[model samples]
Target: MSDAQRICLGAIAGAFGVKGELRLKSFTSEPEDIAAYGPLESEDGALSFEITLTGQSGKGALIARLSGVNTKEQADALRGVRLYADRGRLPALPDDEFYHADLIGLEVFDTGGAPLGRVKAVLNHGAGDLLEIHAPGMTASVLMPFTREAVPTVDLTSGRIVADPPEGLF
Candidate 1:
């Protein structure tokens, strides 16, 4: 399936125990909700599995079992494997909210309509989301806060963002 049709919901952190249980880091608003999206597929769509949440790890990650995964070695092999759910299976967000997948690749512009860059990624480091922008002719990308003041508008239909970055942050 195309990436635009899927939404990455979690990743396997490695084997949780000697069993086939996996340490899953969920990217959903409610961690447990990751399992509610039906079967998930790998990034390349090479593999697909239905997840069963068995428990929660000490670190708050979900402990899950994939349909065919058995034994620690099997789970270990899936370490770092990202899980993607079909976009249609996910709950729709309010107009102000967006899935990170939808934000990536969107064109960014200044309030005056000057082109800034395209969104390279959306990231969060325990604080809030930041939009990584890849501007033309720049060796390094810029990280702009994804806040109301910094990003005044996100037009999904137009595939564009209107950023009002903080002082000196282009």
Candidate 2:
């Protein structure tokens, strides 16, 4: 029932051409595989879409058509909506890999067990995922590199992360 358990696959960028085609921005590693996960639901779980990839576009994004969307206006209307899939449908990750959703709510702590913060989000702007941790008593959130050196341990079952943050990052 918790929407937090789902992984965002992509988003509906609204209708592409006038023939009901959609502009889909895939968030998957293999961009074209967005359709392979089957129907994706809206964040609020209010709507579901069945996507069929038609072809690729200029920016590594795909032009697709959805089951119910058929017009450029319709596609444009859905421009910024994010799409999500059931967590179970996603492929299993390697031992050292993890989905961003799995780390979002994990408690962050120092090597000495001092509470630091909770993960607010994971950001990846080409290099790698960064853990955005939000802690009490701090005016601003901290952006910690999610690498093995900085975040040494991520125990999902325990809902906690042990971070060896850089000096002054605390």
Candidate 3:
């Protein structure tokens, strides 16, 4: 399926044990919910797997077994493979919340309405989410905190974001 129709839920970190279990790093809010959306597809949509979560590993990663994997070699071969679920299978979000995928590519503008840039990516480095904005004639992208104060408005229907970033942030 196309990326627009699917949302990435997690990725295979590596083989977990000799019995074919895999280490999975979930991107879901509740990490374990990664497996609740039913079977997941590979990034290219060429492979599908039914995840059976076995336990949790270090750093909050999960231990899981794929439907057909039964050997360390089989699981190792799939390491680093990202897993995606159909968007329709996911629950709708409450207002004021948005999927990172939806935020990317949205135009960002300053409070005064001058164009700042387009969102290059949404990233979280533990503290909170940040919007990576890429603009013209800039040597590097600007990272703006994704907060109620920093970003006052996000109109998904209009594909725009109105940001009142801290002084000198632009």
Candidate 4:
């Protein structure tokens, strides 16, 4: 299936125990709700798994059993596999909220209407999200804080973002 047809919902952290249970890192606000998205597909959509939440690990990660996985080796093999749900199953966001998937390809512009570039990715290294812009002439991508002060406007319909970067950031 096409990536545009699905939205990432969670990931397999690795095997959680000697049994087939796997550790899950949920991308949802309500971590447990990851199971509500129905069957999840692998990043490439080459495989699908139906998850049944068993409980939580002592470290707070979610414990789950995936359909057809019955051994530690089977669960361990799924480590680092990203899970995606059909976009149709997701709820619409409020005006101020956006899915990182929707922002990936939007063009970015400065206050003066000059083009910065398109958003290559939205990264969150534990300190809020950053907009990674792949500018036309730059040797490296620029990372801009995705804060209200830095990114004042995001027009999803127009597929454009207006950024008022911190001084000298651009």
Judging by lDDT, tell me the better candidate of 3 and 4: 3
**Which candidate achieves the best TM-score against the true structure?**
1
> Highest lDDT among the candidates is held by which one?
1
lDDT value, residue 12 of candidate 1: 91
Instruction: At residue 152, give the lDDT of candidate 1.
Output: 89
lDDT (10s digit) by residue, model 2, range 89-114: 99999978888888898999999999
- Per-candidate TM equals 0.95, 0.90, 0.94, 0.92
- CA deviation > 4 Å runs, candidate 1: none
Which pairs clash in the backbone of model 1?
Answer: none
> When superposed on Cα atoms, how far off is each prediction in RMSD?
1.1, 1.8, 1.3, 1.5
Better of 1 and 2 by lDDT: 1
**What lDDT would each prediction earn against the true structure?**
0.93, 0.87, 0.92, 0.91
lDDT of 4 at 113: 98
After superposition, candidate 3 runs with Cα above 4 Å error? none
Candidate 4: TM-score?
Answer: 0.92
- Per-residue accuracy of model 1 over 1-170 as CA lDDT, tens digit each: 68899999999999988879999999999999988988998898899989999999899789999999999999999999999998999998998989999999999999999999999999988799999999998999999999999998999989999999888876
In candidate 4, which residue ranges exceed 4 Å CA deviation? 58-60
Local lDDT at 59 for model 2: 64
